[model samples]
Target chain A: MEKIEVIFYIEALSNEKKLLERAIEATVESLKGEKSIEVKDISVGDILEDEEEELLKYSGVIEARIVGSFRDVALAALRYSPAVVEVLRPGKMEISARELMEILGDVAVFMANLMEKFGGLAIYPKLDDLPEPKIGYSRDEIEAMIVEDRQILYRFVAEVYDKDEETARVNMAKALSYEGCRINKLTVQKAPNDDKKLLLAAEVLSDFETLFQLMAKYVPVALSIIEPEVIDVTAGELQNALTDISGFAQELITRPLKKQLMDRANTTFRLNP
Target chain B: MREALYWEPLEGGKVRCKLCPLNCIISEGKRGSCRVRKNIGGKLYTLNYGKVSAIGADPVEKKPLFHFWPGSCALSISSVGCNMHCRHCQNWEISQADESFPYLHDMTPEMVVAIAKRYGCESIAYTYNEPVIWYEFVLDTAKLARKEGIYNLLITNGYINEEPFRELAPYIDAMNIDIKAFSDEFYMKIARVPSAEPSRRTAVIAKKDFGIHVELTYLIIPTLNDSEEEIRAFARWVVEELGDDTPVHFSRFFPHYQLTHLPPTPLETIEMAYRVAREEGLKFVYIGNVPGHPGENTYCPRCGKPLIVRWGFKITEYNITDDGRCKYCGEMIPIAGKHAKKRYGAEWW
Candidate 1:
């Protein structure tokens, strides 16, 4: 099977650095659990350097090579462009050019859709049209609106967790809420999904930073439980393994844990059904 | 807005509000920490007086007050604003808002009492948010309700000052005060207040001084305030200061607001806290939030028999005598009701 290489260049202007960072991180994590696209996160450059000549012995199609500015990171004033997310790194044959394009669309949707979510410009193939602007708000005002949009999630949390915030931080943070309204069907801007999947993904959600941090810590802790006599763990292997284990762990730990919280939160708060 | 008490004018146009422990010093035209009281023209005024954000007939059990008229309903009412900004505030929609916060109706003291009576509620509860912040409104309503033979229950965070609380005490028959955490840092950092002293002080004043039926609620957040030592110490404090008869509820925590990153407290943690409380000499202990967890049901400490069987707010069985005693052992359960509501659903009382 031949592998394809696709590069992306995403440009956007967001006042919030955290939002932009999450846009990138979620785009990467969002690719998880896709049946068709086998997204193996490996450095194609490193793989090429190691096994470039070996591939010359075999007659195989190049499949495809697509490149553009993949995504951009703006830190205060600094910016980085062109992050290449490889779906094919000299792998076995089965994937076609059409499948590669679809996979490319998936990756592009991640960067494009996420950047668009922050009210920023998303540069992707076949998606440059803009929607009419509703209102211009400062970051704080926009934050307040987001909190307003998810009042129940936030109020329920405040009721359950009992957080005490004294000064400006809490007062300011209180302006943001995790609680959101349940809409069975809603329009999602750049979610990576087909018709049915995108519709399913359109649900109430918020705050991935803490979740990302937890995941960041969860892998090492989970892997540490393995007690490998010989320590030879790579970042990619660890992440891939974590992804595999997370699916099983989700059923065993995460969902039940959440249901426990949600059931109690709903019942005790007598939340509206 | 109505004239507010427990405030004094300072050197500047700002006035200091003495209602709760936050003791917010407000500039003219500025509200205090609770976002309910404002200092207008060197005098304080409460904007939320008689402005009810949430008013509903809720089971006293939903308030997690098992001993307080078990299976009866309380007409729960709350106006916006609270002095402390607990990040995990259950009612932040109302509690963390300014008095000008919309979504509230104009219900006078007469209307509040009348509504409770209309619903056949066992009591009128000043609850949902911290009740102490709406001092004047609760004061006026409770006084009127007392005249009408309606019990006034104040569900609070135990952060009120001595004088104002005691003055309101005679009118307030029973209260479920939330003791958020034993750590002062938890009170200061998590609840965004100066100290836990006000909470401790309020519990003492409510139970010992005023002779009000005071129940305690502690929400156990995972890795935050779920330590057995801290919980046991809190239980010990309840037994020593409040009394052995005090009903303590170790409620479970769910992810919400800014604390969504936190997972739900492990069931084992809640169970362990219950055991610690029972070990401490507290007579009535409860585990809340998790419905069908046996702990939600009331039990007689003497006979160890389930008195009022509950699943969430619904009462499934009543094993208590009509006079608030265990039907099995004939031991008094120290509850406020003449008889537990035998039928299903709320509003039976």
Candidate 2:
């Protein structure tokens, strides 16, 4: 077996140029820290504005030369979803049966996560009906909405409260539940085939910062906010995003992922994962 | 959300919960050791306030306060969370539950009182889980229940601090405190608490200081806190501290929760504990979790005759007078309140 050298071209786009640059930096740092993946050189391009999208939208790309086993490179490519993978060494690559099996498992896990997020998105049957301009919501108002909304569903992922696992699940659900916000679904199970940590999933409403504040009493895990307009596959443009060639596999992956991955693991992954 | 009864703000947006002996100093957006009390923005709140995880009309003997309105029915209610994490907890499904446990139904103090009255219960038992963790709701409900002519009983671990216990004691008419074992080591190891001394203190205070009818339950688990020495010590303590009149129930422990590897308490262990308690001068000793056993009946301390013969939680025959004197020997039994009118018919097997 020969160590493979490759150039991974990664790109990220965000309204905030700093966030975009930082994400690329973090991705490179993550790759460097990955086992069996050696970083040789790095070329980080300057942040460029996208005139077509908006005045604020910015994008950045980074090209890195890395040497690693085929398995490690494949995992990195799956995880990071780089724009391009240009092989710098090995005219022919050979992967053992075990390695191929492991790669398939990793791919299954990746698809499972992606499908879980889509399944989560599918829960909000009336996402299209959400009166959204995607504007700033005051913390107090959002809290009030979370406490008052009976129809809209939100998702929260938290670590199992080690001191008391059952209570952790209860507390997380209770923290998010209010007068109108009922915990429609809640589960506490081992963290995605990893027994060391417990994962809790709850369906309720919360703002990002307030969700962290509320969940902090139960578990010390980070939470991500899913904006209605982030990709409204429920509506016209978002639905198109799913129907397009790039999103076709994701559309097909939802049902099986929910049954196979979510049901088997008994843990829901973060939408951002 | 209900503001907790016994807590004070601390530095760095933290709060110290003084409700129980644990005295958990919780940071902002974190719960105390009980998992029911949370510190939010330097203020402590009882998260499970009015969160009823379990509620039922149970026989008063089931709370196992045999001497307190012996044959009456108590509307027992419990919220999730407990201060002490007893490894052999029977009701771990609810006791170890968090405030936000999905099955918990929202209840108010008034609603609980109404339900108890509707059920014709003479008393309301804050039970199943450690009621001390549900201090805010229990206190509020107990006070309301007391005013409604409904007796308030605490089926507790007695792991509470003096001040909070004192505050709630006035409303409590009777309590069956679970003294897990005699030694602090057993308390630390099994319940994961620093000491069982606090429970002892609470028991004493409930009996001597507040005049609350206090009974003790010592669960006998095989190979764990079931030693003759510990049981004898516990019996001696009850005799000395809680007085010879205290009705001590030596309940049998079955494999449960974290202690599934351990075997159920043998009949001999329960019998031996009963014998030891009697030898230690603790009168009114009863064996629990053993249905239809001879030791389940109340025996007269002076006459050595069965005073109240009970089959399971049902009293088959009662020999005690309305004034609470043993019918056989005329010895005054330390029974609290009058014997409640028997509610069970012959069909209640």
Candidate 3:
């Protein structure tokens, strides 16, 4: 049988006292029937500068370090360690090298399944008051944890927005009313559109109002356009308009009235002659 | 007031929370990552809205915003829940738990403003937890506080999204943000967050874009992130990105919460880190959590004279003029508000 060496990189010896003990115990148990298993505890002082690279070069050396190992049954014993579960979760590990990567991948999966089935079987030796073991999870487990955590975030956001959307829509509607009023006021002056300036202004105002009203109906969509520095107007100006209108459609729809009126006046003058 | 500040409904009965960096895409009857904002029946509501878990009057320096109102007091308040789950969180009781904690005290925005006025505080600090999680409540309080001529302060982790942060920036007068560490790996392993880029970006926006007086705090833990190289890298980044004038507080960390077994950070490490920062051309670097350390004093960057003497949170000697200039050397300091003789004692809080 080929000999394999495993290594574990334990962080904060004091923080992960319990988890480390459990890993050692499990490794010892799995190799009970094996003939060629070995385990060693390397002190922080013993690690040399080139040890990390040298370990990689050695076929049996694990990335972290072996807290414990058993002769002949080394592989089987290591498989029973609780840390294996964490190493097996989805999105956890990213293997850079192809050689022996497939075997490691299989080991990760097997460990994850074992952990899931026999939860809390591994015991962490206590250093002090810190109770939770600082278990170094496999790449997949870490990714899974991230995903799970994100799910909680998703749930929280959904609840808040879902409840407040109506009020937001109403506020948006009220805020946009100024645009329509501005347009209407412009129209009352009967400004000429000969230079096409008034006509262009009216078109711009009309577009603003239309967009604002549409935004009120669907608050998020409109906000997406306005928030990312995409909107042409300043936030203060937008806020002022929204506050004046008291309804989304009225503020937005009324903004272009003045420009539209000026254009109409210009067209009337040109046609009357 | 509504439950949350920035959120919108989406297709298929989903909602998007824009309050913080998580930008949580919440399905029906779900909550955001902070666990404060929730969606019920496709509507959003803030569970911790107006829930004041902690409140007190604290000195401005206690907020550790050394550049803003040096010798004044601010009414500090905090609700619950944070966007990130930092393993070494000092305020885990409030920032990590759900809404079931009994410490919550319900107070409206009007009440908060009134309390600040009653206490004669120069500002109101939204601290002890990530203030972004309590967006609606903070917004309301800020609006009310502004009306009463009271300034608003935020002591935060700076993990907020750009849009919502910009929206709230106008209402905030000053902020003390935790930069944590310079490495993404440290951030991910320690804070349980994927990236530190968002925090860095938020710090920039808070200082330059919003014009808020920004100070930085970094708690140095032994072995994990107290290396000389890491310290130098962090200090350099602060000087390059946040400018030399920015005050960086390198605080000593005591074992707490999940990281209790680790020994307390050595005072020598803190001193070395401070020296590294100064060598990197940082003008204002202070060491915290150690009492009577000389590093607490603010020395004139040009001339090695102690401008402000501090013992813990207390100011023993204040040598800066009302115009924020050194009285002896006449060199101007970058601090805000009027300077005076140390008016408050160390035990003011």
Candidate 4:
């Protein structure tokens, strides 16, 4: 393997000046502890206090010549989130197929785990906690059907515009008997000085068109289909979905590394000039 | 409200609407499947009778009835509501709307005929939405239009039942029916209808039985229906059932309404459909939604010469004799009515 030198520009923020300075010193010392890396130089800037945030932030750059394989350098970037990484020497490096796959697999697993954690936070009030409906199928039953049979369910709250409330009830009764449909609730309300209208909330176990057909039976003057507020996905499906997404994520993760190490081997930037 | 035809009153004020194959059993004060026909006091009433939701003076070719009165202007009108709930409806604003749409304009049959004359349109086109759902209004207007020597054209999905279609067939002079696709699976999945057999059956009856000038349109969606085998089957059906001269249009599908996730139909797919249809031995084949392709023009079936050159909906060149014979090879084109002179680029306003 070719030896490559890289410069990592990193930043650390803390409420106290001592802690901010200590964090940067410890990061450089940790990088030198690795046997495959040689610490060439460490430059630390003065800690500055921000009045807006009420915190002291210190910035530093570490110049290290790494003599390890490609996996070691990539693992370093994943371990420390640097503001920017610049490769200084041995512009281009090549690795075997196994190393490339290992690097991508590590990033994919990390991303999948992070997404799962955040997804768990976003999904709250488990399906069991939802109040049971008085009229139709329970949420748990519907959720189970969605996962098991892969049946898509749609909820439509149709407003039937009519002068008679009895007619709306009769129509709702007929619609409830339609195949693959369940009436959750039906309410008849009249706006002030306006004609009576029926607000019928129903769930249809079919595609968008079947749901529409179920609603059209009422002859609604106008209707709107409401989107489901919460959806729960099984861990198996989430893993499969993330596996498909990882292929695209691999390109996003590797483009910058390839550009810095291979594409711009002879290119140099003068920041002060 | 005008009393709707083709409905039978069941026991207890309920009525079964026989207007279309859907045959929705409607309760009193409720509407049938179309959303415009309501059952009131033991009678089915057509709520959209003479209710015009949209109106335009469009070129007949825009309805894509290329063989029927080639360059004539048609007074196109629509009343809201549709029979089938197609996921990719191009005119969902009107087709998916109810009779309570705020922009509805009330125009009687006489007024529609008068407007057609006022606009110098030779034909009145019941279009934009499915005219089959607006059964009562279209029947009344077409009857009046026929009496006034004006052609009645129905641009529809042809989802109507046989009895209603037969009663209204005499008044209709020409029809451009959208076939959607050939497979029943595509129909069930995308259009949410049980089958597309009704559309094919209607086209055959309109052409063979009634002798009404008929044309077919198939909007080709990417993976939903566009396949060489499917297009060939459609073309073969058209040739066998509606005859070889029934002009078939392969229209390009754009992502619209609920199908916004899909990409627009590629030009290559449209061209492939055109080739496939022609390979099935259909004489008159055209491509729609594409402006200047060679497939947009009408060719002499016998001599293979471009008889009429069109750019979009405008006829740029006409090469037919006074008697409807091709000027190039004297081949008798299966034209329905006399060709109207070019309305655009003329000195007369």
Candidate 5:
């Protein structure tokens, strides 16, 4: 009978209590389900409660010893456990816990083995109180959302007649009525090479027709300085909406969307350098 | 979240949602594609139920019901979620937003009725967002509003299945359905739907089966579905399927949402489309979004007179008599509404 030992570190968010419990249970369950490995007692110990401990410390410990056929056995079995499985929460909020078996499989016992060789030994089953999100979308529901349309800030360049910020503001208002749009942020910058030129950046939300109608009235050049980036559209235009719309089009780049593009093209070729 | 209207249990703690044509078989803890319907613990739940995203008072004419209670106002309400991802969606924000978005206002069906009565709104319109997706909310509100003698109107994309829509029929009084485009290709690619036939069927059922007042609006996006053939076909279909007096609104499509790169529907194209619709044996074809245009007025087809004068949402004159007959020719206008005569009697006009 061959015996194998594996260890790894896992850190959860500053919160999430139930998460720690399920992670530990799932880890233990995986080893229990392995048919080839004759189970020995699974030891989950070591409360990392040193009075002065702060960051980079252990929270708990999980150790299991079992006679197995493969070099690394029980951990590989846990990967297929249906109940204590790791699942993504679909969209932006999906965060996964670091399963000890999966992590130890990839990262290996480097730190623990190194520390053990030097006479220091400590380990914690790192997890916190983050809640697990259960997402159960059927085939039809997923397809509907996938086929749904998304919106992003549509940026278009228009030659402007005014350079001053006040006139630029007026030009925007004159072009698109404030009835539909709300300007959330505005930044002012000077043209890199030419101090005589000024750039006006304002984040405004309106319909595509109204936004372009107003923007086209003002020129997009720095000297002409009429820029209204789409900060957010009114709620009327958000049904079946995509949360992130920045990828919809690449033609007109807004300030926050890609501020790096605002730099002067010839700045890299400055004669002074 | 409210329990959804139509869904069945699937294997492995999943549920198959039968709300719209997108029969989403949702796994446990996952949501259907609408973002409002979630599969929680093997049960389908509608998240947008009673969660009002946008609500306000709009003139019934704004609903463009043209025939249904023409001059009255409706307390329009909507929650988030739509069946299609139309590139030119005008009200995409609330319609496309998830149920958790901060702006959603919580209200019950009873409360909606109270608001309409308080505001003197003759009807309550489930609008702005696609009303079909908010079925539970609309069903509750529509039933309550009907009992209160307040009309219930659904301004929707009309992308709904027969059973759910028919279930809503008894309570819904009128609906302003957006036809989008007459072609299946437009519905498949631009509107992101399997086909346009189902949507057309919803309109038919709304009027014929349920006897609900129905009006259709076709957004004329330039260089897309604004061809004369589509407009003529749509007009012909209305006459054949619904009727000649169906009141088809040829609304000018401005570059909106994803279709912003294109220009606002050209006036020439709208004029041509309007002419084509009228020539195709359709009565009551109206042009919208281009304010103060002569097409905004409702003219008597028999008398050849401007029967109802309007200046963009404002009714300047109504020449229909107390009996729903045209003043000049005494021709029945096929109009169904609470006329001024109902309030002021014979001496009003």
Candidate 6:
């Protein structure tokens, strides 16, 4: 296992010494067998001494450090530790990629709740540098690993689109285009064709107007793909990619055209059958 | 109708109102977002050209500007319309409506100058509304006021674009710009504007670029934005970006306008905010709106002696020298204009 070192800069020691000690104990317990932890300094030390005197005068030099395994499990455990929690209180606790996905899942559920309470305009999401999930991953894996972890992306969309569902849907659709997926229909229809391949194909058929309207209704789920600039593809590349999804291409092509007939059938039968 | 100030015609029947941030691109018979400037037949016309809706002889300290003119009465005048629609606006009646409102008083620029001179006021404040929205009127009055040896003051939201702000900077002697909150969320939700970051940028520009005496006021509303961390971040930004010498006023927010359901900000919250700002190395942090509070007085950052004693808008005692130095400690304070007993009027808190 590769060794990864983490640092925690603690401040105002005199006011919260007992709390700090408890946090350190919790951190030690959490990191047991995972990696090594050390208390480097208790007093102010030079972090940026050579910089301007004014800058140095404001920030008191006291920082902490924690060393652990670079593996996803160890890193996640270290980040979610109580000591880390106490130190980074009021700010989002930073964690490894795997842990980030878990947090993102929690965030997605939170976004759903926020949307229900305040309406669609309250979801904003952001994503940083992270690899795209494998193309053949299941919907569960995609939702858990890639879709759920990006918080900033959701927060951004929530703030921008707020209550305006169409814009939010459009943004989400645009985001989905990165994963070669398109959200063609956001209905309760869950048939055998309602899988990742079909969903991805459905997304390709989406236009900006339709996507925007969808985003407005649903709370924006902030998901970042492997690439930041996904909209820069040529028209030829867009068409070729959609055609590549061979298994669901025919079904995806007729999905939009079949929506009217499905609605008409339900209305004619009164759903009594 | 008088000729307007700060405008130039464009090529294709468009007149750019170079007054504020909106830079209103006017089509014939259409008005800008401010509702003051209109494009009439390819020419820009200011509707609130000289319409004074509110006029008062208020204590200079009441402008909530402690460093400028210390304690004096300024003849304040304002026209209707604002570039931004802040939800917690205290003066929305004057700021939100157009000049066509029933309360508007028809006073020309010259008449405004005359009224200030008649009231024996040392300065004229273009306040009670966003002065930038009434650009032509403010510019004209400022010109006349400057020529007459009277100072021009502005209590503005500081949301104007750079060009217009620079154009108006020369005339404005002192300003108290409201830095509503540090975050973009607060700006969007509370101010209903795109960027509050611009206001901070403008403050630095006002102080460094234009050399205008600038002070900042932040209303501490409970639950919404009255946190120590937020206030500390704000103070640190001000001290770092604007400078430690820049006086920051942490004003108490009372339930008003659209945000009335929430109770008035507690006095302790204001005090805590003041403490946070002070702890963040801000030299001068004062509390406003809550009268008789100790934070209202200006004290020497080094010696801790009261430099300018104030009660509400009244100056009970003045100990600073002519050069704005403390009498006891001899430390220089960052105040503008000359010191005179006549300027410091007697007003009970």
Predicted model with the maximum DockQ? 2
Which pairs clash (backbone N, Cα, C closer than 3 Å) in model 4?
none
Q: Considering every candidate listed, which one attains the maximal TM-score?
A: 2
Question: Interface RMSD, all models, one decimal each?
Answer: 19.3, 15.8, 26.8, 18.5, 23.5, 26.6
Q: Encode model 6's per-residue lDDT on B1-349: one tens digit a residue.
A: 2334566787533578776655677643346778877654345666777788889888778887788776666899888988888778888888889854656678887898898999888899999988987877788789889999888998988888787778788988999999888788888788877778778877989999988899999998888788888999999998888899998898988876789778889999999988899888999999999788889998998899887777787777788888778889889888887554554333434
Docking class of 5: incorrect
- State residue B282's C-alpha deviation in candidate 2, in Å: 1.2
lDDT of 1 by residue, B189-287 (tens): 889987888888888888888788889999999988999999999999989988898889999999866787899999999999999999998888889
The predictions' CA RMSDs to the true structure, in order, are: 19.7, 19.3, 24.1, 20.1, 25.2, 20.8
Q: What is the lDDT of residue B78 in candidate 5?
A: 83
- State the lDDT of candidate 2 residue by residue for A43-104, as single tens digits: 89989886755333798888888887755665666566666667766654443434433443
Give the worst 10-residue stretch by lDDT in candidate 3 chain A: A151-160
lDDT of each: 0.60, 0.71, 0.61, 0.70, 0.63, 0.61
- Write the residue-wise lDDT of candidate 3 on B199-310 in tens digits: 8898899888878888999999998899999999988888888899999999999997799889999999999999999999999999998879999999998778999888
Off by over 4 Å in 1: A1-273, B340-349
User: Which tens-of-lDDT digit does each residue in B1-349 have in candidate 4?
Assistant: 4678899988634689999988989854467767788765456777677889888788899998998888898999998988888999989888888765656788899999999999899999999999998888888899999989999999999998899999999999999999999898988888877888888888888888899999999999989899888899988988888788889999999998899889999999999999988888899999999888999999998899899999888888889998999998899998987779866664211
lDDT of 5 at A136: 34
Q: Provide the lowest-lDDT 10-residue window in model 2 chain B.
A: B340-349
| TM agreement with the true structure for every prediction | 0.57, 0.62, 0.57, 0.58, 0.58, 0.54
Backbone clashes in each candidate structure, one number apiece? 27, 2, 79, 0, 43, 37
Choose the strongest candidate by lDDT.
2
Model 2 B-chain TM: 0.98
